[model samples]
Target chain A: MDSDIRLLSDLAPGQQAVISAVHADEALHQRLVALGFRIGRNVLLMRRGRWAGPLQVRLGATDVMLRRAEAGLITVRAA
Target chain B: MKRIALLGMPNTGKSTLFNRLTGSSARVANWAGVTVDLASAKILLGGHMAEMVDLPGIYDLHGFSDDEKVVRHFLEAHAIDVLAVVVNATQIERQLPLVLQARSLGLPLVLLLNMADAAKRHGMQVDTARLAARLGLPVVMISAKYGTGQAEALRVLAHSLDAALEIGPARHAALKSVLSDDVRIERETAEMMAEAVTQPLLLPEQVSDRIDRLALHPWLGLPLFFVAMLVMFQAVFWLGAPLQQGLTGLFDQLRQSALEPLAAVLPDFVRGLLLDGVYAGFVTVAAFVPLIVLFFLFMALVEDSGYLARAAFLTDALMGKLGLDGRSFVMVLMGFGCNVPAVMGTRMMRERPLRLLSMLVIPLSLCSARLQVFLFIVSAIFRPAQAPWVIFGFYVASFATMILTALLFRGRFRNTEPFVVELPPWRVPTLRQVWMRGWLEVRHFLSRATRFIVLGVIAIWLLTNLPAGATPGSVATLAGQLGTLFAPILAPIGIDEKLTVALLFGFVAKEVMIGAFAVIYGLSGDALAHEFARNMNWVQAVSFMLFTLIYTPCMSTIATIKIESRSAAFAALSVLWPLALAWFTSFVFYQGMRLFIGG
Candidate 1:
């Protein structure tokens, strides 16, 4: 569990993982899901911007940029 | 009547979904609020009708943004029968919160997971029933691109409406209370995904790796980007040339054959006015109509096909260097077609400073109207040998000016409001969607251009027709008097009377500049060529050309800027700032050239 716990940005670009859980509220959750962060799907972190603030992740190749605050909510484990 | 609203984050294929379900492409984009207007259509649902309204995409219902207000107030006031939250299947996690929020709205909601084909290709799977049960709504996975599962989604929506009437007592509740149940629902959905869903095999890393490698490599990427931009511009210029020629030929023939015969029956004043003013004005404006239409076609293709997001992503590095926030790409792209839409598009930028700065810089982007002027002048003056390069140089100069100005204004905007843009999977845009969208944009431009050009030509004719009409050197000869009034101010800028009058009328609409030029030179075939060499002189002509290329955007663009920025001051600044910069730059160029040439 400790080894699996890492900042979502730590995932290699285009590597797959599942959103084990999310910490944000229902509104933020829905927004995240709207951006393809739903649980069980393989999420791929594609590109991260300067200072790792906003990153483009490929949730099945529909790439989207998400802020760290938003990204932090999606707890993922390498599949 | 029961109302069904389509809610989604910007660019989640909401409009595409709307089009697929309703069969109309009201300008879908990978960017936000491509459908700024709320468009509604009815679809037959299980022997009944469901009225669906496409709401503007807003990140939060809490925000004061126009789109947000549309969704927020509607939910607050009206009892929406069904809400179709069009979640981008490829980017589900981020899309989920909107669904949760929509759930809080207490509508009978159906989650339409769009972009599933792209999602599945990336090795992702979703348990539809689980997601549906978890959110306490029916969830249907569909690909808007392929129009798959759309009908099922609609059918589920039909059931939801029926369920709503049956379960009327359970409709209203606090969001917190409702979400407490959704938590349990989500837990069950997670289990459902574990049992029922199998993640598909995504193409192994190399394709994206190679593309991203070349696309983001600091040195290679910038040159590639410029080449790509040049290619797009070249497409706009060269590909549209034939169509433009054809349209021009049509108008020229019409003017000669139809209008020429009609001229004799009319009184001399009416005849002169028709040929010299109205017919001539339409020809000038209409010649560019094909070019505008083609450019819009190219624009819609780039946008709908997801190349725009790639451009945005690739140029983010350069944009950062210029101190423009991440969101300025949309505004800049909008500027290429017309600055007004570009200025208006800046409203999507959450940062006040970024929006304001975008408004200011957008007018300088050399829109289609200025492109017309550049093509006309450079072609007339320099010939094929030098025209393209000179025209390209103006683009480079404008680009340089935008970067410099944004750099100067960098510190003004400290931070951008957090931006999250979904890049829909790249696909070839459908011909039907592209053509319809292109036609709409062209229609908008033509209407605005024609209306403005008609009044403009008539007014200029009237002003010039007064105080001893058309007596050789009389002030009543349209060009002579207006030219006289404009001469003193433009003299220092190296413009003579003929060029001065054209530039003066040019401030009204850039398209009007052509009509003004034709009017000033008496509409002869070689009129532009002769005036450029004789009345304007090389230095003044070049100076005037540069000034016209950079100055205030057309009236339609000004109106668009006002709409997009949601600020009168920002809109006025968009017009004033560019004009001031163009004026100063032209003055410098002309003065420096005069001294250098020892004139």
Candidate 2:
């Protein structure tokens, strides 16, 4: 992995990235992929809830909120 | 008649489309299923009657969610002529893969681009004709909410269904190859979207983002959510109380002026049964309609505005600590209005274990019905200044009981499905839509609750009136004898022989417990309160309140749990666990308080 690349959770709010890979438990991996998270999809970190809650990300026009623990498994590259 | 099923991802305006096509009420919600699970209607299409079925939405066909499984199983089991796949035109990139997957089913397919009006406003375009030609499938751009190109969509749908009927095996064989390689679905969806639709690489500065700044703020979001909930709950009470009073007065007038004079020819006993027994129970339930309407009205506003999901996000951290997810928070909130719909609303939850756990704890919520009982009892004993404090104490107990129940049962139920919820953009709910949603819930409450109330009251009337004139609720009557026989079990909870009868009948509806008091003791208004004040002390009152707060909420709620969970064992557990908890808690409180106060 490139030094500039990081987990999707590390992106600051308002920062954008492209999902490089999704590494999760088989069920979660399927869910993420089924929800349009692909290798090359661009994602913009929208916001996070209080006390390390879910992170909201804008994948194209759709916004989804997922737990940060799930986001940690998805590696992303800075856009 | 041919069946055309409208299938799609969640919040694609599928219900709006169903309503548009069939001219019926599908009970629209921006959030997931609080209304009809599978709404079907008959429509005359191409001068032939056809069934238009709307199934529950799913994020993916092969997903693990119960809804997804239902959709997949439904498609395989049912012989449907056409599958009309609806896509949010604005979110085609995220939605198109579902379309591709649905296409793989080898059904006659018609692509309906819903929310085209919103897509247009967002500077997006989908060339439907070109896309249809490229994919070799019929596509129509229609905004289901705004009724744009609705007729064209229906016409194309009818043609697709007829074509499927005529070509049958040949068309299925041809369409089987439409999906090709499963691995290439993503790339194909991307390439196809690039060619057919033009959407902004970035959303055009959504209003949802601006509001979400504070609503989902790292620091302020959780507190703000509590504040929003507090306001919603209090608003229902503060607003509904006056209307309740007005309705009460109106019913009183109607009975005195109309029922009395009209029934003057009847015997006094018959009139008393009509006026005091059945009519009073009816009045209690009917007078509560305003509160239920307001409660659901605010619920619709919060849900339709899309803040409910935000609250879900905010609370997921806390809920996660309890072995539940954000979705459970929403169900618990709905329980505040009424546990029946809240338990039903658990259908949106994809996983069964968490949904079952939610059903168990939801009845523990201090729902408005429980609150009604508390208010009546609190006013009877506590001073006006102390009323709020006592009720607030019960609220605290409600939360504690909910948390405690979750903590103790969390091990048995295990954890929840991952919470990856989509936050739909805020759409200001129209008054008509709000009213429709509210009316649907109110009708649900009335239909299920009124049955239980009337039947329960009639049963109580029989128990009181039986054995050939036992003085109607006297010691010799069935109800009174039954209460006394059961009095030993309730004695620790500070509920007496007479209040015991009311509690037993209260399983049907808690709101009628006070009315039952009038029948049991043959007292009303100030006299009933005076009777209570003279008989009970602070310790006993508190114990009684705690017991009522935790017991089986109502019969309809238990029935909803049984039906929704589809497990008689679990439903029985739901009753037994709460009843046991109520007894234990009340025993501890009643005994401990007696020790402290030296009674």
N/CA/C clash count, model 1: 34
The TM-score of predicted model 1 comes to 0.65
> How far off is each candidate at the interface, as Cα RMSD in Å?
10.8, 11.1
lDDT of 1 by residue, B161-198 (tens): 88767656345444335444544554577799899985
TM-score, chain B, each candidate: 0.64, 0.64
Q: So what's the TM-score on candidate 2? A: 0.68
Report the first chain's TM-score for all candidates: 0.80, 0.93
What DockQ does each listed candidate score?
0.30, 0.35
Q: Name the lDDT value of residue B19 in candidate 2.
A: 61
Clashing pairs in 2: none
Error of 1 at B117 (Å): 42
